[model samples]
Target: MAVASVTYLTRLAGYIALRNRTLSPRIVEVMEAAPGCVLISVIAPHFVSDRPADLAALAITLFAATRLPLLATVVIGVCAAGLP
Candidate 1:
């Protein structure tokens, strides 16, 4: 698949580019924390919005997320948001 190929190629490129390099402790720490930062950046705004529907859906999603798999949590969020 195209997605798989792109993912593999990008990883290979990164490996080739970083070959024989020693990363500093700070750089390694940043790399480890980057995904959490990115995830928060994506989700933070949704949590702070003034809309009731948005808040309700996010709350339901957060609750479901604690007890369910990711796919089910996402589905619950989608269905909750679609409620009339």
Candidate 2:
């Protein structure tokens, strides 16, 4: 339909634009870290907030993220956030 055709053309245009381009190693590294940087930007306020429970949850989530797999980290983070 109309939506599908628009989506396809948009993707095709992007592919054509970048088909012959190569990113530098430094740029690639920065791009790889961008998601984590954005995540921290979003969460930093809550982590530094005045709420004790939120602080505790942030600490637990940070520790879990460093030591556990993605699924486990998310599970522990959720549980920590829900703790009294």
Candidate 3:
């Protein structure tokens, strides 16, 4: 739990720092969207049996949250759960 918290904090800090860098608006938008996407992907069904899939999902979730739309994020999360 401690390690997980630390990792989360570190990722958040990095996210903030990246946001502060003032990239193009398009880039920023994408960045914002990435986390949501990744989160959805992470929780996707079939995520239980395959470690590789889990990692991929986690990466996607992180990526989507960085720039993905909030609505899309929620939808993806919901959809992921339903996936076989």
lDDT of model 2, residue 59: 94
Q: In model 2, state the lDDT of residue 68.
A: 91
Which portions of model 1 miss their true places by more than 4 Å? Answer: 1-33
Better-scoring candidate (TM-score), 2 or 3: 2
lDDT tens digits by residue: candidate 2, 23-74:
7888657655655665666678996699899999999999999999999999
Clashes of each: 0, 0, 25
Q: Please give the ranking of all candidate structures by lDDT, highest first, separated by commas.
A: 1, 2, 3
lDDT of 1 by residue, 1-84 (tens): 664566556556655777789988887676556555656666789989999988999899999999999899989988998886
lDDT at 34, model 1: 53
The C-alpha TM-scores of every prediction are 0.57, 0.64, 0.36
Model 2 TM-score on a 0 to 1 scale: 0.64
Point to the candidate with the largest TM-score.
2
Q: What is the lDDT of residue 59 in candidate 3?
A: 57
Candidate 2 least-lDDT 10 residues:
2-11
Q: For residues 14-57, could you state the per-residue lDDT of candidate 3 as single tens digits?
A: 68888657688888687667656654564465445566655555
Compared with the true structure, model 3 gives a TM-score of 0.36
Candidate 3, run of 10 with poorest lDDT: 38-47
